[model samples]
Target: MSSAAYERIRNNPKFDKLVATRSRFAWTLSAVVLILYYGFMAVVAFNPTLLASPLGEGRIATIGWPIAALMMLLFWVMTGLYVHRANGKFDEINAELIKEATKEAQ
Candidate 1:
C-alpha cells in the first residue's frame, strides 16, 4: 500500500478508536495476569506455611498446587479471550479501516 493509504488510515477517527480500544483491553489483561502472579508470589514470600500445608487431612498434595494450577488456567483463558477479540472485533474494525482507506486512496 502507498503512504497515502497509510496516511488516510491514520487520520481516520475509527483508527484512533481501534488503537485505543485494543490497547486498553490488552493492558487490562496484562494487569490482571500481573496481579495474579505477584499476589501469589507475595503470599509465598510472606507466608510460606500457608501454601506449604497439606491439601486435606490425609492428602499428600499441598494447597499451593491447585492454586498454581488455577492461576495457569486463568492465564490461558485470558490469552484465549484476547485472541478471540483480536480475531473478531479488532480484525473486523481493521478490515473496515483498510477498505475505507483503500477507497479514499483510489
Candidate 2:
C-alpha cells in the first residue's frame, strides 16, 4: 500500500475533528428520521381506522391524508437539511483535504 499521499491529512487534528463531528451529525440525523418515519407508520398501522375517518364536514380532508402530507413535508425538510450540511460543511472539509494533499504532492 502506498502512503505517499494523505500523510499530513491523516495526522491533521482539524480534519479528524471535522470528520468525527460530521459523521456524528449525519448518523444521528439519519437515525432520527428513520425512527420518526417508522414510528408514524407503526402508529397508523396499529390504528388503521384513525386515518380512515373524515376530519369534519364534507369539505374537510381525511385525517390520514393530512398526517401523510405532514410526514412528506417533514421528509423533504430533512432532505434539504442534509443537503445543506453536506454541501456547506462536509464538502468544505473534503475540498480542504484535497487542496492540502495536492499542495503536499507538489
Q: Worst 10-residue stretch by lDDT in candidate 1?
A: 97-106
Off by over 4 Å in 2: 57-60
**lDDT, residue 40, candidate 1:** 94
Best by TM-score: 1
Question: What lDDT does each candidate get?
Answer: 0.95, 0.82
- TM-scores vs. true structure, each candidate: 0.91, 0.77
Q: Candidate 2: minimum summed lDDT over ten consecutive residues — where?
A: 1-10
Model 1 clash pairs? Answer: none
Please give the TM-score that candidate 1 achieves against the real structure: 0.91
lDDT of 1 at 79: 98
Tens digits of lDDT, candidate 1, 1-106: 5899999999999999999999999999999999989999999999988998999998889999999999999999999999999999999999999999998766
lDDT of model number 1:
0.95
